[model samples]
Target chain A: MFTLYEFASSGNCYKLRLAMAQLDIPFQRIEKDITRGETRSAEFLAINPNGRIPVLVTPDNRVLPESSAALWYLARDSKLMPEDPFQQAQVLQWMFFEQYNHEPNIATSRYWIHVLGEQEKYAEALAEKQQKGHDALAVMETHLSDRDFFVGRDYSIADIALYAYTHVAGQGGFSLDAYPAIRGWLERVERQPGYVAMEA
Target chain B: MFTLYEFASSGNCYKLRLAMAQLDIPFQRIEKDITRGETRSAEFLAINPNGRIPVLVTPDNRVLPESSAALWYLARDSKLMPEDPFQQAQVLQWMFFEQYNHEPNIATSRYWIHVLGEQEKYAEALAEKQQKGHDALAVMETHLSDRDFFVGRDYSIADIALYAYTHVAGQGGFSLDAYPAIRGWLERVERQPGYVAMEA
Candidate 1:
């Protein structure tokens, strides 16, 4: 069995859980509390020197960190990935957008405002993050305007990566009112086979 | 031939230029002036809705944006990628670390100080970035202290993704004096066959 080390409430970690469910991959999860700095513990650092969670330890004992990397590995030969090489790169394109442009802004804001109850403490910073998170949503909305998914005409890990945080963006103070296309895409993603919610 | 849209001074853009040179892939360069806001223009936005440079336009006219994705595309079947599945995911782990942790701090500080000459204007922000950037450098130092390359004992796109900004981290005011391992690894990346300077 695979062993997934994660923070249950973190969408980055949730990406692995959702992907595992959809792919029918069996894994045992070990929760790490980020609030208490468990991820930064010396023992945790040994597993990932950079000290982040959502790491996957395969049945063979190989360690893989980073939610995107873990998702890619799980989806590699499954129906979750694209067959075309160019489409595969497009998948990476959206995933990179999620990491670089989406998650940092959306997830960070949520962590501060919702998870840490620091809405007022980080008011100034939250305002800035809120604007950028909307920009990221706008990009996603425009992309999903003409297509059902982010990449070719199918559901892929790209959707899973972006959906992890986007579904709960209100926790970051982002409203989906302006992004009908993105909302529609989110529904389509939820309806995919064996799709699991983060709370699970 | 590939048509590479770039802001030449950006290491993110340089990742593509350097990768193309190493792969012996011929490409025409279309320089975009980011300072003048060219990337955000409607035409460029049509090319990449995210409005970022280092976008690759294939000979067949397929447009692929995001430097990491383009590098993965160009290196997919080449010696630049690892044949092992787990090792390939390790490449993504480091690349995500570059985008999320390293670039935002290191490259942003470089842009504020080295490129924009706004050192004093953004002094406070730069200081925080400097600390975080060093943290990123320290992680690279420890990782490289024992390994020759990022994954599977061979130089891969993970190196190119990281080497783009890391080798020039000094411009970001991050002194590598304490990171001899990182310096040595930089030299190793420089010696790879078909490697070309960023300016070319």
Candidate 2:
């Protein structure tokens, strides 16, 4: 059996849970409270020296961390991944955008504003973060304007990567009202086959 | 023919160029001056609404952007990508690390200290950037102490992503002396077949 070390509130951890659910793959889950520094413990450090959540340990004793990487691992040769070369790269393109443009802005804001509750200390960085965050959202809005899904008219890991955090972006102070296309796309992803809510 | 739009100094763009050279894939190169805001031009924005560099236009008129995505596009079904499902995900793990931990610290510092010439403005941020940058380097140091490459024993996209900026990290005011393993690994990558150097 696969074992996943996950954090309940982390989108990165949620990605693994969501993928496992969608694939109907059973796994033992060990929840680490990231807020309490549970991931930094010696035992957990042995699993992933990076001290991060969502470390997926395979049955063969291979440990794979990083949510996107875990998604690729679980979905390879399965219906979750695209067989076409170009289509697969498109999925990666969106995933990279999620990391570079999307996550840095949205995730940072979430950490500072919501997690740390340090609006005053991080006040200067907030404007830049908000601008970059909005820019990322704008790009996503444009791309989703004409698509039912991120790639090949199906829900792939790309959707999983982006959806993990985007659905909860409102908690980070981003308004969904301006991004109608993204909002619509979010609904479509929620209605996907075998879909499971983050906490459900 | 593959047409690549990139700037000389972008490590992300360098990843694609390095992969293309390794694959022996011939392509036309179009230089985009990211520093002067050329990526934001109306024409460039038409091809990539995100207006980012390292956009690859394939023969079928499909445009693939983002460095990691483009590398996968070029290496898909080739010997560059591992056929094993788990190993391929291992590659993605390092690639994601390159994005989240490595790029944010090392790449951002290089862009700021070396390219932007805004050291004073970035004083506090640079301090934090250096700490995080060194932390990431330590992670690579520990991983490389035992293995030749990041994923499998063979060279893959994982090396391409990290090596692009790492060799030139000194330009970002980072010291390689502390991480002997990473330093040695850089040499190993440099000695690889079809290895290419980023512009000095």
- The candidate that wins on DockQ is 1
Compose the digit string of candidate 2's lDDT tens values, residues B80-182: 7888878888888999899989988998889988888887889888898998888889888989989998888888989999998899899888989898899
TM values, all candidates: 0.99, 0.96
Candidate 1, TM-score vs. the true structure?
0.99
Q: After the best TM-score superposition of candidate 2, give how far the Cα of residue A151 lies from its true spot, in angstroms.
A: 1.1
lDDT of 2 at B137: 90
Tell me the deviation in Å of residue B95 in model 1: 0.7
Best by the lDDT measure: 1
Q: Write candidate 1's Cα lDDT for A81-172 as tens digits.
A: 99999999999999999999999899999999888988999998888887789899999999999999988999999999999999999998
DockQ per candidate, 2 decimals: 0.91, 0.88
Each candidate's iRMS in angstroms? 0.6, 0.9
Q: Give the lowest summed-lDDT range of ten residues in model 1 chain B.
A: B191-200
Best by TM-score: 1
